[model samples]
Target: MPSYAVTGSSRGLGLGFVQALAADPSNTVFALVRSISSAPKLQEFVAGHAHKNVHILQADNVDVASIKTAAKEVGRITGGTLDVLIANGALMHHERNKLMLDEFPDESVLDDDMLTFYKTNVLGTIHMINAFIPLLRAGSTKKCIIIGSAIGSHKLARRTEFTDNPGYAMSKAALNIAAVRYASKYRSEGVIFLTITPGFVRTLQGTPEEVEKFFSEAEAKIREKFPSYEGSITVEQSVRDQLALISSVTIDRSGDFVNRDGKNVEG
Candidate 1:
């Protein structure tokens, strides 16, 4: 059986990955969440999917000790091996004050937000690399997959970019480098570290009128940027596509950054 562990599996893309991977029944999934109380849906899913080999582990991506402890538990259960680990947890909060750097109205907000992004997305993810190294070393495929954003690409910033997402973009860029460094270090051991972008996924649903207005503006920009693009894909489609990409990746392509469609992003 293929053993998989995913962080931030309580919601969004993380939850989708868990659902898709566990559907095969041959995959033993460890869904690492922060806490059971904070993950009611995940808790319920675990209870219902125990027969499906879905186990929920409590761990926070930002909390190193928690991750180490969870990893130990999973290592014992899986007998010291893990096939795939999806580091999907991040700090892309929508409520943070937007900073444009040059035209930002406030400086303190930028300072605080930058630290938050670096700590969670960059440093915290680095900690995961350390905590899970043993399990990856013992696993079969030894794939360490990171959920990165298209905004992380410096070339994408020059070609096409979103407004007011500096923190998210900056942190993601840092994470890309961190992932590449780890992949370089472990490549001789056959560990495949891939940073994959899910490509413009429509995660937020809205009313008819509201949706029309938003998509009209967003889709127009997307079409203007990539003429061949068909706009945002559904979360289910994105997850399915990403999983395919993950399975197909080889040691030769390790440390690469690509979109959900299997295209390489600019370095």
Candidate 2:
């Protein structure tokens, strides 16, 4: 069985990945969660499934010690080998991050947002990669996939209308750089460091603000910009499409950033 470990498996796109992976009994899935006991949907899933391959382990992205412990447990469970480690956990301070340079928020808010975004989005990814390197080295596939955003690319940023989230974009850009560095450092050992953007996955589900305002505004803009646009896909579809794209990545493609449709973001 191919062993898979996905961080932030408690909700949204991460939860979708866990569900899709666990549905296949051929895959041994590790659902790394921040609070497995408190995550009702995850708890329901674990209770409902009769499959032995889906295992949930607790780990907070911002908590290095917890991630280390979780990594050790995964290593032990998978016998020190993992086929894929999806570094999917990240923080998004949307409103503050979406502000333009001249429209920057208050100094305190900007500082705090940038700091927390980097800590969780960038450093947390590095932490996952570092903690899992040994297990990856022992694995057959040795693939380390870091989830990223198209907004992160400098080429994409040239279109100011869509690149409004300067802070979040900057953080993701740094992450892309880090992923390339890691790929360069580990390529000889057969480790593939890849970054994939999931496009827009409709992250907010039932929140009133999201339903009434956020998604509607986003959908309107998408239709206006792209004539063929169909708003945002469900998280399930995004996960499904991304999994297909990820399966095609090879060591040669390591550190290259691509979107859900398998197109490179940099271009």
Candidate 3:
């Protein structure tokens, strides 16, 4: 059985991944959320669909101990092996979407925001990998996938002149580097560490007007970057494409940062 663990599986792209993976009864799916109460949607889906293969575990990304504990539970359940570890937990403050590096109110505020992003997006993911490495090493498909963003790609940023949300972008870039380092270290052990963007996924949840306004602003920004760009994809489509890419990718392409199409995002 292909056993997988997805962090931040309470909602959005993470929830979509859980739904897709759990659909296959043969696949053992672990949905790691901050708490069961916080994941009503996931709980509802599991209960409604009667997906016996889906396991929900509390795992806050900022808490290394929580992640380690969740890993232990997964190891126990999966016989000390895990096929995939999907690190999807991240901090993306929509309010800060338009804030440039120097546009912050003050240096202190900027530092606080950047540090918060770093703690979750970079350090937390590193700790998660550390906690799950043993189980992954013993698994059949040892793939560690980090959900990255195009904003993190220096080449994409330069090409599109999309310079905003510096903290989020910087943290994601650091995460990409972390994945590459892990790939290098674990290549000999046949563990593939990859960073992939889910594309422009429309995972926003809010009032209808709020959602509309958010997408309008986002589309404007996207148009500024790519004139011919279309709208965002559904979370389901994005997860499907990503899972397909994950299944086909080999160790040779391990350290790559790619999009849903399996093309390098840096290009």
Winner by TM-score: 3
The order by descending TM-score is: 3, 2, 1
Clashing pairs in 2: none
Query: Model 3, residue 194: displacement in angstroms?
Result: 1.2
Q: What is the Å distance of residue 49 in model 3 from its true position?
A: 2.3
How accurate locally is residue 224 in candidate 1, as Cα lDDT from 0 to 100?
A: 88
How do the residues 187-221 of candidate 1 rate in per-residue lDDT, one tens digit apiece? 99999999999877665546878767766787888
Task: Estimate the lDDT of model 1.
Answer: 0.84
Give the residue spans of candidate 1 off by over 4 A.
Answer: 205-216
Local error of candidate 2 at residue 183 (angstroms) = 1.2
lDDT of 2 by residue, 106-218 (tens): 77877887787788889888998999989999999899999998778887566435746677787899999999999999999989998999877777756777576877787
In order, candidate lDDTs are 0.84, 0.84, 0.91
The C-alpha RMSD in Å for every predicted model, in order, reads 2.1, 2.0, 1.2
lDDT of 2 at 107: 79
Q: What TM-score, to 2 decimals, does candidate 1 have?
A: 0.91
Q: What C-alpha root-mean-square deviation, in Å, does candidate 1 show against the real structure?
A: 2.1
